[model samples]
Each structure stands twice: as C-alpha cells, then as structure tokens.
Target: MSAASLPGVRLWTGRVLEDLRAGRSCLCLLPRTPAGGADAAAVLDELLHELGDFVLLPAPGPADAAAPRGAGLPGPPAAAAPPPGGPWTDTAPVLDYDDGLSAFGVGPRGGGPVPSDAASAAGRDTPAAHGPAGGGEPGPSAAGRAPERGRPTAHDLADRVLKELGAAAPGADSGPAAGVDGLLHRLTDGSGAASRVVVVRGWHEPVPAAAAELLRRLAAAVKAAGLPPERRPRLLVLAGPSGLAAELPEQVARDDVAVHWWWGVHGRLDTATVVAMARPPAAGRAARHQLLEAVAQATVVEVCGPFLDLAERLAAEWDGSPDTLPPQLRRLLCDEGLLPGVPDPDDAARTVPAPRGPAPGAALPAPAGALREHWDRGLADRWDGRLRHWPGAAARRDPRTQETGAPVWDWEWEHGVRTRIWLAQNTALLPLLDEAREAFTEVIRSRSRLPLPDLAARYGPRRDGVPGPRPGTAAAPGSAAALAGMELGDMWRAHIQGDARLSQPEADRLRTLWRSRNSLSHREALDSPRLEGLADHLTR
Candidate 1:
C-alpha cells in the first residue's frame, strides 16, 4: 500500500505539512510503533521522496542530544532498541523546493530586512497541497559537508548551513557564529528562496545532558533572535516519551514548542481502519471486531507482526463459516483449557473439567505459523519444556501441568499468584504492578460460574465519597462494602482463603499485602527488594 494511504502516515503527513505552512519549528514526539506497523522512519522516508525544500539532519550524538529534563519527571531512560537503517539514513539531508514555502531566503545574523521581494512573493503564492516533486538539486552540495571532519555539533551544523545558503562568507564569524541562531538569522534574512525547515531525526533515543543543554541554548536563541515570519526555519524534534518534552524545562513549557504524543493504535490510527488493512475482505464482521479489541489489549511494541499473522490464520480457518472465534488471542491461550474454572471457596465447584478445547463455536484457530512465535514466548521462558513462564504469561498457564502434558494438579494458589507477582517485579513503576495484579484477578473472574456482569458488579468501584470499610469490619446493609463494593483486595482475599494450599497465616499476609497496594503512588519509586519478598512469601 502507498504510505499516504495508511492512517498513521496520513496523521504524520498532516502534522508535518501543518508545521511547514505555519513557518514554525516542530517538535514532533514519536512513539514506538509495533513491529509490523507504521513508524516515524517510514513517515520520514515518504516525506523525503515527495516533499521538496527541506534539509534532514542526523541526531547530534548522545552528548549533544540533551534537553531539559522536566522537574520531578524521570530522566531519559534508555530506548528499548535502536532503529534499523533501511533506504534512508537518519543523518542525510533531502532538499526540495517545489512549494512556495521553499522560496525563503536568509540575511546574515543581525542583517536587516527581508533580502528581496521576490522570495516573499513566491512564499505567499505557494499552494498547500503542492503535489509531490523531487527536492531540487542542491546548489552548494547539502551532502558531503563536514563528513571527513566528523559530524558537526548543532552549533557547527547551523553555521555550516548558513555558509551553504550564501548568507555569510565561508570563514565569517558574525557574532562568534555560536549556535542554530546564525542559521535562523540567515533563513529569516531573505537570502534563500522561501521559508526552510530542518528535520532533526533520531531524537527517539534517550537525550544526554550535553545535548539537552545545546537545545536549551538554541531555544533561548530562537526566542530572543526575533527572526521575521518568512525567515523562521521550522526545527522538528522527533522523539519518544522520554525525549518528548526534554527540549523544554517543564511540562508547561511544552506549549511554546509543539509537542505531539503517540498514544498507540487507539489514538494515532482508527481501529476499524487498521483491521480492514490487516484482514482479507471475506473476514466476517465478528472477526474484525474481535481483532480490533485484541489489538487494543495486546502489549504493544511496534505494529505487531505476530498479531497480523494470527488474524490471517483465524480468518482462513473460519472461511465464511458461521463459527465465532474468541475475541482475544492472549485470553484464549491461558484461560480456555488446562486451568478450568476458578475454585470458589463458598461453593463446591472447584475443578471443572477442561473442555477438549474452547466451546465449539467460539474456538480460536490453533497457534501455528506466526502465532506460535508469540505463543512460545508466552509459554516456556527457558524453552526446555519445564514450563517457565513470564509473569504475564504465567497467569494463563495451567499451574497443574508440565509442558510435555504430564498431569500435576498440585497447583497452589500462592504459587500461581507468586509467578504473577514475579512479572510485577520487572515493571518499573507501581501502577503497572497494579495492572498485572488486575489481569490475574480478571483471569480468575473469567472462569467463575457467576455471570461476568455479577462478578464485575461485585468487584466494581466504590461509590463516590463512600470510604472503604476497615479491613476486618463486618459489612452494614447500607454500607459501601455491602452494596457490591468489594474491591480487588477483597476479591483476592476471598479466593486465597478458600484454597487449602495457603495456610491462614500466609493468607492473612497476602491479603494485607493486597491492601498495601493502595499505599503506593504512581510516581513513587518501586522498592524492588520489598516487593520481591512478597513474591517469595507466596512461593514459600
């Protein structure tokens, strides 16, 4: 499919064009796209191929990459991984000027007036939907500058760029030629044709302290320089969450610099649109609906390839039949077989027989081909078939059996809960830990004999202003706890108490621990050793 057709690409293109038209610098905050989905690199490639009159710059290494870390916000953590290079290099510059915006010219720093009326007239006449044309040939060679001498700093690049634009003499040090200020002055001075833009790629990686400082200086210069509207070259900063607002001193300061965030597929692209693109036309409405929901719930990385593969298999297996598959692939793997229904303490229904598979019409296609890779990763971590599952995957596996199909229904509630908690330890923050616990609670809820709605009500939120009952207090008829107000802590305790595998003392500790979750705040640093101990207690 053409890049322009994808929803993600369209959203990206719109933003870039908006920035160019306004003659303002852009600071586009990029998110990591799933493995098979649209990404910033793809968008940039499309722009280079079609858009004219822009210069692309590589990231100044980690040293020059830093921006202000927001107050009390976490420092730039490491990026998950570096992006792979394809047809384009993040450092290369692509210049094209088919649009009127390209007619911008720059005067020298401290130079007076728009250089010429011709440049201004051309910019005013440029059309917004200027069709794709090759970036016109470089006058002074945009490529091959500062190569053998090593990549230049932002300051040096800005200086070199001005020299290329003919705004300054080759060795001129107008006001010491310090930063991007010189380049900005030239672009605004009317020395070039139309307003120019410099796209700074690869800010997706963590920004180091020095680079942060360089950006601060540049921002200050931009603010103070007072370049006219026509000469102001847009500087687009493309980065991930950590790198998002790092160019600014605080979150509020982000307003002055355009900050666009990527909120995964749900926000950046339409769910129905993504589904339509991934599945065949014959795929049923129900399958498409399920795929949309699954994509939302799936742990996003990039547009996940495994997910697309699974969707294809599901559609092919159904083949226009009326068979309805389970909406979620992850849920299907863990909940459908081995474990059966969750054992309810007050009721005699403990181990319901596992159906040979999912209920007849709702069965999911087997995890084969692309699906198996994710499934295998979801299963044994050690891969020796000893059933070593990650925290997220552990909750779904049958705690009672070995990987080779040996029966060992000696699974204890504490052990299962402990494995889930193990997953929690890997997370960097508290809210995520709470999410992992909630997933475990939901897994058990799905297997209960009680209707899904009733279980949900019993476990739903407490009424506004109604305080939680003291941990051990008896429920009053009209009190919040009595009106189906049992929180996750309560539901978890009840489940733990009914399992004989956990002694009363262990159960009490576990319940107390569950309630303790409320004490942790989102911003609070996790005490790993302390949480790990709780996991140990569960196993013991």
Candidate 2:
C-alpha cells in the first residue's frame, strides 16, 4: 500500500515534512514489528527524495529477527540523474550540499535534478564526467554501479557519516569530547548545508560507548541546532525494543523535541480495518461485512490468510451437511488453526503428552477426591498448629531495651517472623496444588462441619451431639506414613508410572522435600531448593 493510504504512515510523513519546513528536529519511534519498520523507512525514503543531503544509519549489532530480510535499500533506489550545483550553493557550508546529496542520488525540494549515486560517483567528483554535459539524465544502468556489500551496522554507519562530514576522528589526542564537538559543529555550525537531515537507527544495540554517547548528546544538541531556527538540521532517531528511549532523556515531554510513536500492527490495523483488508479493495460492503466478524476475531493481523482458509474449509466441509455445529466448537477450531504462533498439527503431535493413566501393574488408583480431601484438612491443621506453637512463639521482654517492658520482641522472635514472611513470599509452590487444595476443601466443607471427608464417610455422618474422630485413631496427612496408612513415598510411587514418571532416585528426593517443607513451615530452617522441589513435584 502507498504510504499515504495508511493513517499512521500519513501522520508520520506529514509531521516529518512539517518539521523540516519549520527547520526543527524530531525523534520518531518506529514499531519493532516488520510492517511498522518498513512503513517508517518508506516515510524516510519519501523525505529523502523530497529533501536531499540526508544520511541513513543502520541500527547497531545483528538486525532484529522481526526486521525485513534481504534488502537492497529499505525503499526504491534513485532512478534519475541529479542536477549540477544549483540554488542551495550559497547556503552550502564547508562541503557543498550537492557533494553529499549525490550519495543517494536525491535532489532539493520542488522537483530538481537528482544527483548520481555518490558511492559510484565517489571516485569521480563531478556529474559531468558520468552524465551528459547539457544535464541529460545519466543513462548508465543501475547494475553497472557497485552495490553495497551487506547491511551496515550502526557503528559502521556512524563512522561513515562522520567521515562524510570531514570529522571522522576528532583529533588523535583530543578525546571523545572533541570528536562529539566536531560532529555537532558539522551538523549545526555554518559548515554543513542548512536543513540537513540524518536518521540514526539501532542506538539500543551494544554500540560502542563513544557512538552511544554521541546519540545521547543529540538529545541536548537538538535544541541547540534549532537555536536560530532558520539554519537548524532535522534529526530523526529510530530506537528498537531494547528500551533505549528510557535510557536517554525523554523527548515526548519536551517542548522543543517532537516525538512520534509506532506501536506495531495491532495499533494501526483494528478489527474493521482487518476485515476490509481481507477482500479486494473494490468489493461491495455486503461482501466485506460478511467476513467482518470472522476477521475481527483473528488474534493477529498476519493470520488473516489462515483465518480465511479455515473459513473456506469449514464452508466446503458443511456444504451439504446440516449446519448444527456449535459456535464454541468452531471458535475452538479457529483458535487452534488461525491464531498467530499457535502450533501446527505437526507441532501438536510432537509435544509431550500429559499423564493420563495410572502406572502399569498398579491397581486402579483411588479417586483423587479421597486423597485430596485428606491432604487439605491435614495440612491446614498442621500449618495452623505449627504457627501457634512455633519456637519463640511467645515474645520475651528485655528490660534494658524496653522502658515499659510490656513485651520486648527478642532477635529470635524477629528472625522467626522475618524468615516465615520471606519463605511465604518467595516459595515457588505450584498453582495446581492450590487449586487442588481449594477443590478438596470446598467438597469436604460442603458435606459437613468435619474437616476430613474420609472420617465423615467412614463414620457414617456425625450424630447431633457426637464428637469428632478419636484423636488416637486419626493422623494428619502431613505424617510421612499416614496417607491411607501407606508411606508417603510409597503412595507417590504407586500413583505415578511409566517412563515419564520420576525414578526410584526421586523417592529419597521426596523424603527430603517432605522434611524440608516441614522445617520451613515451622521456621526451623530456610531452603530455596526445598520450595523448588515441592513446586517440581506438584507440576510433574
């Protein structure tokens, strides 16, 4: 699509052109996505053709994975010959503007002759030698000229631009300050052409300290460049996802700095826009509206193709059949097949399956309901009792430390509280455990006031005045051997089976985890691995 056709693209280009006309500098944040970046570059290309003597700097380090691959230039290269030195000659500073404009074969505003490619014309200074004397357009084919070797990194681009400005090195012993000063002078001083434009991308990458410093300095330098307003240069800095924008001073809040943000495909293409995109531009409203809901449901704009394909398949499959399929089931199919980043059929087949059945040679395992109920009630009672009767549970008073001596908390008490809080905050308990615990509690609570479902089930419901289970016969599930009167380790072993389950080595691991968990809850010791192990067991 043409740049003007996209709302964001139009806004971006319009503001940039407005800034150039006003002799102001702007910072534009291109989206990190492929489409957004491409549109941003297209806006720049339009700017280049409209206003010459500009420099394009690539981002430092490896190109982002989302960036477009295998490029010539981000936009179409120059196709026509450039004019000889003309109107801006008087305004040209140290090196004439024509000399720099030739680099990209761009020309001045209002449709002037475009310069020859400076890379090719680098060896040959004047256009007369390469083109007709009367200024007829250069006839040499683009293939005749040498092409750029590969994508240039940010540092490399910075060095080239500095060299172009006649300030490659600030002076051997003068240091980075001098180099920065020299480059700034080239941009702002009466040495470079008025209204020069420069684009520096990828400042967020691991660029050299010196290069990074130069970019940061530009934030402050922009105001200075526009001091006189008439001679200001237009600077556009494009940052990526590294959050480099946060590292540098913000421009969005600054009155002198104009900031534009591109928030990727979702930001620009909404539900209605996407539906329109699915059909030919000239299609009728009825045709467009027919697929509007389906297109709107697509999770990602790039998935429009797959979504349309899925719709087509569904229609063909049910052509002569009854249309009795539930909408929810069709939605599930769309979610699975048309959502961005959703695994394909091949991927789903390759994925490791969840545990589905009891291990071989084991009796049909007892329903999770009984075991879950026992664990929930038993663990909660143990945790409550442990908290109440924990060591240092009673505060000890130190007369010297407390004037009133009402109840001075000792270091032991303080340590206990702190350690308990830390463990509670940092433990990596699995969500599934909490879910199971809650389900079990709700089931038992709904049945009666008794905590353990097994006890209630076994005793055949409480009589109006009957006491709870006899203390001697009952044991909390926290006890290593109380679960179904089977060893906790053995119960775990019997519950899980197959190659996917942990081996015998893990039984000892389970014992250690159990011991450590108890100690942690009792505030006896602090161990991160114990918490991690518990998490692992629950998740597995």
Candidate 3:
C-alpha cells in the first residue's frame, strides 16, 4: 500500500506540510526501530514526490564531482532494484521540474533556457549539461570527474544551495561569501516564485561542527527575516533516530524549528486504518468491524510496523469468513493477549470452579435475594467483577434499536464507558467495597444491643412482618439463622438502619457505602473523593 494512505504517515505529512506552508523549517526524525525504518523512508519519498512543484533541493552526497543541481540532486542510490517478476516494481518517476527556467531572472517566468552570458557569469553549465532530461544522470561533462568521498562540509552545502537558487557563485557578484549568511541572502532575497524545501538526509550521523553552525545561522536568519509566509524557505533535516535534537544548536530551538518524530509510539498507525488496509476486498463490513476491534484491543503498545506486517500476512490467507476469525488471526490475537490461549482439555476439566459464596466462619454471609441473583446471574455472567481474558464486557445492546430487531452489540459503547467501568471495578473500587462490607458488619455486631440473628430475621427479606422462627429456634431457610446470607446492600437497608444505637451521622456513613455498592453492582464507579472517604470511614 502507498505510504500516504497509512494513517500515521498521513498525519505526520499533513503537519509537516502545514509547517512548510507557514514558512517554518522542520527537522523530521525517522523511527529508530529496524521495522519502522523502511516505512519512514517510504513516507519521506512519497512526501518529496507529492511536493513536486516546490523547489526540492536534496543536499548533495560527499562524492558528487559537480555542485548540486536544481530538482536533480542525487543524495544516494537505491539499495537494490525490484525483481522483474516481483509483485511490485520500482518504476515510480522521480521529481523533475521544467529545466528551461533559470533559478534567477535570466529567463521569462513562463519558460526559456538560461542566457549564455548569465549562465557563465553564475559559473553554471547549460541545463542539459547539469543533468539528464529526467534528472537521472550527471551528463557527459561530470561522468569522468570524481570528488573526495566524505561528509559534505558546511561550505559545500551552502554553495550548492545558493547555486540551485540561481544566485551567482559566492564572491562572483560581490554577494555575501559562500556561507550561511550568503545562502540566507538568496533565500530571503524574494526572487523565486516557489518556496524552497531543502531536505538533508543522513542527519543521524554526527554533523560537522561547521555544518551545525551553518544550520543554526540559517534557522535564525529565516525566522528573523520578515518575508511573507509563502516566500520563506524551509529546511527539512531527516535523521534515523531521536536525541539528535539535543545536539542541535540552541538557535534552532529558539526559533521553534518544527521537529516531526516518526518512531516508537509516535509512529503507530490508526487501528481502523490498518484493518482497512489489510481487509480483503470481498470481506463483509461486519468482518471488518470485528477485525478492527480485535486489533485495537490487541495492540495496546506502539508497534505499528510489525502490526501492519502481521495484518498483511493475514490478508493474504484470509478466507473472507465473517462468522469467526481466521485461525492464524485468532492465534495472533492469543499471542497478543487479546484472546485466551487454547486450553488443554484435561486442564479445563480439572479447573476449579469460581466460588459461589463467602468462606465458612467469614465475618459476613454471602449475598442473597436480588443482590445474590445480580451477582451470580448478572455480574458473574458478564465480567465476573474481574477483567479476565478479554478485559472487557460483552458487546452492549443499543437501547434505541432493540425493539426493531435482534439486539446488536454496540461495539462503540463496549469500547467506551463499559470498558472503563469494568476496569475500575476490577482494579480500584471492588476491593474497597468488599472491605467496607466486612467493616459495616463488625460495627453493627459491636454497637447494637439486639442479637444479630433477631435483627436479621426482623429486617431481612421476608413476607409482611411475619416471623418464621424465634432467635433460639431451629434455623429455617427464611429464619434469622440465615443472617449469614445477607449482603451489604440487604443488611444496610433491612437490618443496620433498624438498630436505634446507630447515630444519624453513622447511619449516613453506612448509607454512603450502600450507594457505592449499588453503583458498582450496576456497572458504575464512585469518584475518587467518595472512594477515599469510604476507605477512611472504614479504618475509623
């Protein structure tokens, strides 16, 4: 797929374009990860081609014999050409502007060759001699010439930049000498119709002291210059890793030089976009949505390149089935911790079942009645008051459309508040609620004059003031003997408040706990202050 179509690439490129158009220079840092390196490079190439109309002057490599040419600077050769029968070919055209126009006013704005006298005065060869028609070769004149191969110096960079702008060779026209000042003069001279984009590759390498100083000066000069936004030149430095920004001179920072980082988490692609890219043409919308959600949950970390690679692999083998995920995709999700791994049949059979009630001799009884039913049939069936393999509740039903058709899972809501509440209950609030229940039970047992069994029998779930058995009688299902079966909500409403010893403020404190308990049971969470207050009250 084209890099421009990738969400991360599009976002970064759009921001850079905005900076350039606003006359701000940029320093683009490529991803340090090996997998992302190729993706960053592809995006850079795409951006360069996309800005074809701009004066794109790639800084010359150290080995070039002649000065850099306009729209034809060869920074480096491709590592290898695509194979003839490969799935893709490398036939994309290079960025080449019309050569008839000179960088200065030697030719008409429409189009014409540079005047012979003007070309010679500037020490420039005819446009044809500078490079081939398509910006491919150095032409016959430069073919046999060889230059020292090492990092280009600050002077070398400045000279080429000035020449590309059609400024006379440094010191030729009594202009500023070939250096940062001279280059700035030409760029801010207000001569060219198009903005200049000077893209310097291989910036991850140690920059020469002179080159670094030159860059600082150019950045400062561009900012200080009051040229219109469209007329200001932009400098884009491309590097492989990060931390290089610190090495740059402080002037670059002071001027607010835009730094675009494409690495690590910063480079992650949108999950939906990646899924779309990897989806088979024949896949149904439901299949696409499912895959998108699975990927979003699976990729909790920033690893866009590897994730995209896996998605492509899945696409190649996908059968376009909508009912279930492809086997390979399922295994991938399992490995990513999104789905549960395959369980051994013997282990599954031997696995202990979840506890259905409080342990024997506990301070309080397990919940009964509506609260018990809710715990078993509601919370347990959904999230079990804990986030397990999926870390999310089942897809929620949309109330608005439930009457018209079979309920459909609202994936959006599932990913939103539902997931958040589930996380809070499992991680922060549920443990405190459990503690509050035990504390409330102890307080009641210690403070009240009435026996716990009699209190429960009088106030706990039963029919219309009709007592089953006296406190000392044999315990029946609905008798006071079942005090242990009442949960915090039932005990608070049915028993705790019935005790006259509980002061109004104390009763109110217990009420707070009851409300919080209900909120959690209904899939909501108390705010931090309430939770903290609840904990403090329990400790007291």
Candidate 4:
C-alpha cells in the first residue's frame, strides 16, 4: 500500500454518525480520495453515503495522482445532493474531491467554521473532520472556514470556531461519556481550557480542509478559554483506515480523546477494536508538558529506542505515544481518567519524582520481523511503528520471533511493528491475561441484565444521601455490619497487593500467613492466599 504514490485507503469510520442525525454534535472521519493533477481543491464533488449525506476530502498533489488506483476502484460520482428534504442517499460507493462542505452546501447545520477553504485549500497532506462541533459557516467546510480544532485559533477560518467554544461552555476533562457534552459546551462557552479531541484515521490524503478548519477552531477555543498548551484539546489525523496501530497511540497520547465503545457484530463488542485504543494523561507525573508536546508534535529525535523509553519515564506520563503497549496494559487504566482540575505544567515537572530509567531493550523493536533487524538504534527512537504504516496484515502486526530458540515470551509478530513486552511483569503472561479478558467478556455478555444499582432495590429514604440500617440514613454503618469481616480482609489484602499482579513469592508469603492464621482463615475464609499462589504459578 505504501508503495503506491496516491494510495487510496479504506478504514472503519465508526458509528459516531448516529449521534449526528440524532441532533448531537459529533466528530467523524470522512473518506479521503486524491484527484488527478495539481488542482488542489475539489473541482467536482462526490455524492457519498447511501443517503447522500456524507462529506468529501481534498485532492492530492499532482505527484501522488500518478499512483495506481485500487483495482476496481469505483470512479467518481456525479456532482449532486439528496432530495430537497430527504436523508442522504447512495448504494454504490463514491469517491470525489473533498471540497469540505455539506450536501446542503453549508457548514454542518448550526456550527461556525474551523478554517477550511471551500475549495479545501487547507494545509497538510491530511485533514481531520469536525462533524457539528466546528461552529463556523454551518458545514460549508474550508470553502468558508477551517476544520474545527479542539482549541481556538487566530486565523480567519479558525475565528468562527473560537466564537463557539469559549470559556462559558460546560467543560468536561474526562469521566462519564456524557463528559463529551460538557467538552462541547465548554468549547462553545468558556475559556476552552477543557480538553477534547477529534481523531481521523485513514491512509488517503488530501484531507478535507474542513477537518483542518475544525482543528483551528478547537485550538482557538482553547486559547480563548485560557487553555495552556498542556491542557489543549487535540485532533489526531491518522494516515490510513484499516490498520489498528493508530488506535493505541491515539488513545494513549498525552493528549487523548474520549473513547466510545459500541456493540458490533455477533456477541462481540470486544471482538473488534474499531481503532486500537487505550488512554493516558495529558501531562506526565513530573509535569514536563513541553517534552510531551515535543513528542506529540513528532519533533523529538530518539537517540535509541531506550531514549524514547527514557522520555516516557522522564515525562511522568506517556503523553507522546510509544509504538507497542505490553498486553498487560490492555485495561490497566480503566480507572485513571485525567483529573478535571488542571495542574500547573511547570509544577508537574518540579513535583514529579525521578524516573526509574529506561527498561532494557526498551528502545528495541519487538523480537521478530524486518523492522527489528532493519531498525537503527540511531540518535533517536523513530519507533517505525509510528513513522511507517501499512494496511491489513502489515498494519495489524502478527509478530513472532524467528530466532531458532526464542522463548515463547519473546515471540513476535512476523508482519507488524515489533517491541518487547515493555513491562517486565507482562513477560510470558500476556496470553493468560488475554484469555481472562475474553472469558470475563463472555461472562458479562451471557446475560443482558442492567449492570448498575444491584443494591438500588434495597434503597429507602436516606437520612443523608445514603441508605441506612434504620430510617433516614444513606449508607448506615450498621446496615453494612454483617459484611464487616469481609470488608476488613479485602481492604487488608488489596492494600498489600498494590497492583503488582502478584508473583510466586508474594503468594507463598500469603499462604504461610493464611496457614498460621487458622482463626483468620475460618472466620474470614482467607482462601485467597492459595488461589493467589495458584494464579501466580499458572500465569506469571
């Protein structure tokens, strides 16, 4: 795919579009297609979406237009729109010049501008989409404005974006999915300090200028709201559609966007990761946000893979993403949402404790594949996983160490970017954790029961915002007394565990303690010690 000059790519755009027709603001990835010659903007538009409701991307530079189009690549559609009041229309696939406007020849319904030229003369080889968040020109796209940036901008197109997402908007840093609303509200009202993000992943270039314009607005809004660069919202424009590599970095970047999980395909929400994703804080523990920005902006040069690993440590957070995430980290951060209150960027660096230095082979790519052998431990870690991208097999890594006697733990995907299990604890145990995750997913999916308020049924009038043993008390201590021993033991053990994922020594120690505390075992049923030992030996 990379070998092609103007490589047109296809990627799952996700189902966020449902939020659009429902009247909610959203961000989406519009398909990108290059046109022949250096005409830059859209000379002709393509009718997309079965209902003809979709948008288009900009034309590629002339050099790229010479590349081979996909075999059987559908030709462009007629310049057109849907029935006057009808929903979008189309059954056949369509490709056209992304001029950056709506089928209505306007900005998305009720928004301003993000700074895109109607002709989509937007800069960058790639452009992002703002959905309805870009408040300018109501979706006329770059023809009238810029793609909506997460923050406010000073440029003409970006100006429309600033008018919307100011300080007064409801600010959502992170939390419930509803937080997205707060972010949108804050973008439109307040100083725009609240961070939000829009992500675009596709290999096709000539990104619709509307996407860039939207980015400008977001940037402008951030400034209007006094958002320091560290807390600014982000719009991550990916290179292609199909591969999952973009998801991990997009999710874990120092500047992260919220992830919306939806049900897809037979019994498998977990079955597919629309975009490989996870998350991280905007600033590292030390609060060196500048360093983070440098990495995010792709400005740093890693001297070696370890240097990049060292950077991840020095920053106190992994704002700039590394290529490979140990499997053990698949869900390690389900609870650590970025806190709402912004911390002083400088203070983060000052207060952050020193790091433990880079992990061994930290800069090295995973055990197998040409990337491992061909990769140069040059002055900096280029993390080919980030710099180079492909589709399908190449993009979705199938790493396996080719070394004659490599340990199973050292096995690598033969086709994708490679990396060692960055974290020592993940060594030789990712498969087990993956299995557990799969099983746990199956268990929950087996039933369609509502997942919340299992105790709601026992609720009554609250003396204070809690349920009481008697009347008028929210969560009375007395009502919870029967479970006291269990609580105490759980607290004690959890405190000791400290999320190390436990080892045989720790389990053995626990077992000795359990045996010595027979009374504790009979009363508290401390059978966990043995189970812990079993788990450690079997998996770790």
Query: Which RMSD values do the candidates have, in order?
Result: 20.4, 25.6, 21.0, 24.4
lDDT tens digits, residue span 195-268, model 4? 33333322333222323334333433444456444444554333212112223323222221222211010111
Which residue segments of model 2 deviate by more than 4 Å? 2-4, 34-43, 59-159, 166-178, 203-212, 219-226, 243-253, 264-274, 280-540
Model 1 spans with C-alpha error above 4 angstroms: 2-4, 33-36, 48-51, 59-152, 157-160, 163-174, 178-181, 203-218, 242-256, 264-269, 277-540
**Candidate 2: Cα lDDT at 511:** 52
1-540 in candidate 2: lDDT tens per residue? 343345534544666667656765555544333322234445555666766666665423354444564211232112211124321211111221213342443232323333455524532333332345465455221211221122112223444556654564423232221233345656666765435676665332233222333454444565644466666655666543223324233423244445544322122233224334543333334533333222223212222221222323333332111112123223434454322221233432223232233343211111122222221111100111121121211234456764211223345534443443334322322233334333333322333233343433333212354533333445443221222232232223332432113436554545554454445445553333543454444444
> For residues 1-540, what per-residue lDDT tens digits would candidate 1 score against the true structure?
433355544654565566556555545443332222344455666665555666555433564336442211222335423233211112222122122222243321222222234433332132211111355321111211211112223444554445444455422332323234445445544556335565655443233222333344434444565655555555555554343223242331332244443322122133234444544444235544343333222212111122332323333333221112222333333443423332233331112221132232221112222222332222211111121222223223345554311224323433443232333233322444355454445444443445544444444344464444334546543343432444557566446544223446644554645644553432221233444444443333
- TM-scores for all candidates: the values are 0.38, 0.34, 0.40, 0.20
Residue 523 displacement in candidate 2 (angstroms): 55
Steric clashes per prediction:
33, 2, 1, 119
lDDT of 2 at 251: 25
Error of 1 at 344 (Å): 23
Please report how far candidate 2 places residue 346 from its true position, in Å: 34
Please rank every candidate by TM-score, starting with the best.
3, 1, 2, 4
Cα lDDT, all candidates = 0.37, 0.36, 0.44, 0.27
